[model samples]
Target chain A: MSDTRIIKKRYIFMASVFIGLALLLVILPEKSTSKQLKPEQLLLQINDNNRYVSTDEDARKIIAGDNYMQLIDVRSPGEYVEFHLKGAINIPIDSIFNKDKNGDYVYEDILNQDVKINVFYSNGTVYANQVWILLKRLNYKNNYVMKGGLNRWIETVIRPPKPSVTATVNEVALYNFRKAASMYFGGGSVAVPAEDNAPAPIIKKKPKQEEEGGC
Target chain B: MEEVKIQQNTPRKYMNPYLAGVLLGLVILFSFYLTREGLGASGAFKRGVAKVEQIIIPAHVNSEKSAFYHYVKNGEDPLKNRLVYMIIGVFIGGFLSGAINHRLKLKLEHSPKITSKTRAIAAVIGGAIFGIGSAFGRGCTSGAGLDGMAVLATSGFVVVGMIFGVGYLVAWFFRKLWI
Candidate 1:
């Protein structure tokens, strides 16, 4: 073959090969679908008002002892132990979706079950909302954020401002209900009764007493 | 000095540079897609060296004296990693390609002006310097430099540019080795 012919052939071959590679690169997602919700869908979910369970609703559910409702404190273990709802379970915001050795989510039963409604709360909605968004994005149903979190719950239930004397019947009824709940939760926010599901102190070592009579 | 011809008759059969580059680009992209991480040549080697040291002196692996404590800290196994396997795959793939192309040989490749022994000595010294440099730079040419370029990171451009710029400047002093 002549030099010109060989060189031309090589150029064409190179060009065609490159174009083929470019096409492959364009199609190179390799076909894997993420089950997580898209960003826009997640944003909409975040904005939706129905994702929140008001403190009143939360309180009513606890009062009724709804077997289907689960209160999840999305705070540090320390914070949860410091003060949380009467029957709240601690699931720190960071570890909500972590998996066990078997590759199943550690909180999968509590998080994704339709039989149980998981209501997450923190000192504020920030931590609860974070956990809620992540679980919601992962397509977990029956999960909700406790509106205004524990702070609002305390303001409304524990130290409820008495309704105005001219308040409507419904307002008076709500105040009475809150007053009843406040008393049920051990009156004025002393972290419920210590005997009522309060976790024992984690540091078990007794204080060492120096020798009383000897050096 | 006569102008050196880079291409000569019977130029060994090798894949086109452009083809190789495209393949490498695809590999890098796929690496990120699969691992959510970039291609890194030094990380595997670093782990390998650390693992070897751990096997030789188990106590030294985690002690302050060991330079590679980071790899084996908290009883972590440096060898049990995807990168180590990736490095092995790289070696096997390179060998297969070279064999298929009839480019597999035992001879050392060097400039015609230098003896094989001089080339060998220079390569060892140059590689040692580059190994130290990669540690300081946090990754080697393909990992930190090329991977950065693949993602259009400014750091990649800076690293590649500095490598070539310094190379050119030093090549003037070492021209006798080649020319």
Candidate 2:
């Protein structure tokens, strides 16, 4: 075949492939278009205030009390089964928008409750943040993320570090609260050794070099 | 024979690298805009492997014990994945690009210094190693390197740096194959 002829054939084949792709795109099921918040609005809401996010400390406080707070575990069921915060309802991230066997939206019942403060958490903040954003986009109120998720809970509440000798009264108080919280959460107290008894190391500041005059 | 000679002798014009780079950047940005995730290639290969494994050992592929079962356990078709579609689009795009430049040809590309057999063997080994590495890394060059870099992911920068660093380090020993 002539070079031009072969080129023409190839071009035709390429055109057909693109046309097929376009057809597929048109025919595929359209993604559910929920009334979502605009990017700018989301940014403003996420930044303007800490209303959309709850700290681990704040979450623990809520859990300790009889506050009407819904704790949603957004990790996989397997992970949820292994270990999760006490009283957290498991709802896999993938099934957040799915319907249950009874024809009701899986999360409709939980999300529709107006009184409870809905706080979502996962292994880390990423997935929880995603869920928070989605809920916020749908104009769902009282939605907050457990900041740093379970990871932060593990660090701050599960195994809180001891305050240094130079620590302020507030720091020591916070440490004590975390220690108590750890016990309440069933994370046995990590006996922080009395490192404060060690002698403070002497520090010598180096003499500052004279500044050179530039031309 | 005459057509073959003409085709071989005719050197095709290529797109400027900068222009190609800009176009690629635009595509990556668009992908990020549409989907929260970035482009990946190795995931598609993994899906393909999982699909084959499912056919041979349905029980093993379905079992929770297998590492691949995580991808298939949801009962979602592997081929229906976004990465699979993206890879298909990539193949078509590549063919169109090559065709437009008159660069499409039935031949194994290799350095002139190496025999075709040596090049083929090296290519297979390199690909196999890369496939294994990508699985561990959770993404390949385009996915982890380019997409990761675009998103300012630390893993993207680290992987790209390590890949090039190792490539440069080993290039000396493989000089005969290329130079």
Candidate 3:
């Protein structure tokens, strides 16, 4: 064949491959089919109504009680080791949809169609929210994210006296709120008398000093 | 005879834009299928910055004060990541494709209407802005925007629209940067 004809044939082949790829991208379903939520929509949802919990009242119950829900820590492995909810299993966010030895994600082992799975994060709830969205896309029902993440937990729950050198006062305030909120839910301290009539159930934690406590 | 000689000297043409775009989409899909992740570009840049910060301000980079310090302090080899490898693959792929199509050249690409200096300056400025924006938006064209969208991330579309909108809205003022 002439050089011009050879070039024309190559062009045709490349064009066909390109077209095929475009079609594939068009057809793939990366997100869920249910009413999709935009970042703006999610933000609006949080602001308009606190439909999402930073950490639910039942968190302590789950962590301590006999019949407990599985706690999945989606943060990095190191973060998981540094400090995480007691009894929570570490499944790094990166490894969530990742394949294993058989080249399949471990999602099936942790959950089935009926189970309720809760996720939380360190700072503002972006990563956990992302995972929540992913689970929704995968058609998993009853999956929820602990809003405000660990940041909210540290801010509201932990209330460790401000680490003077590292963070600012405002940062400390936020950290206190997050820390307090986490322990409020994770600690199972609902028995404290409510000062407000709104009746928000307070979480109570077993004293850390108490020896032989449940893991 | 002159026409034949002219054809012999001219470099091979670039792949059609539509074709290139489609191939890029497939590359993204293939990445998702194999690794359950999408293609990323700015992350590689961030890692590059992290490596630099490690050398210059080791303490600050390792401290909680800096946003990037957390990953480094985790004992995670920031470079030993799938995205980093994928980015290297992207460079190799782009260069190889360019070579096979005979479009490879050492010079910078710019519009005919702009001066080389202006183009170069714009490239640098654009790159820097892109670097910062990607960090905030959580990725750039390839990373957050495209990959996020392919995975059906709502934020992906938001960032993509914002980036393009901002680019177009400001493009008029920077007309001198490009034709």
Worst 10 residues of 1 chain A by lDDT: A206-215
lDDT of 1 by residue, B3-107 (tens): 232232222456767778878889889988997667777878888888888888888877988767877888889878777777788899989877655566778
What are the candidates' C-alpha RMSDs?
16.7, 20.5, 18.1
Top candidate on TM-score is 1
- Native contact recovery (fnat) for each candidate is 0.00, 0.00, 0.00
Scored by lDDT, the top model is 1
Candidate 1 lDDT, A1-215, residue by residue in tens: 59989988988998998799889989898665548888899999888889899998888888898867788888998887677787778889888778899977777767776567788999989988888888888888888899999889999988888999899999999999999988877789556633446531222232333211000
Rank the models by lDDT, top first: 1, 2, 3
> Tens digit of lDDT per residue, candidate 3, span B80-145?
666678778889988997766556778988889887888888889878877777777767787778
1 against 2, candidate with superior lDDT = 1
**Please, what are the lDDT tens digits per residue for candidate 3 over residues A1-215?**
69889989988998788789889989987774455456675565445433255553434444355233555668887766666664456667777887778965566445333433444454567777777666654545445566677665544454434556778888776556545554654443433332322321222332223111000
Using lDDT as the yardstick, the better of models 1 and 3 is 1
CA lDDT, candidate 1, residue B163: 95
Report the lDDT of model 3 for residue A19: 88
**DockQ for candidate 2, C-alpha atoms:** 0.01
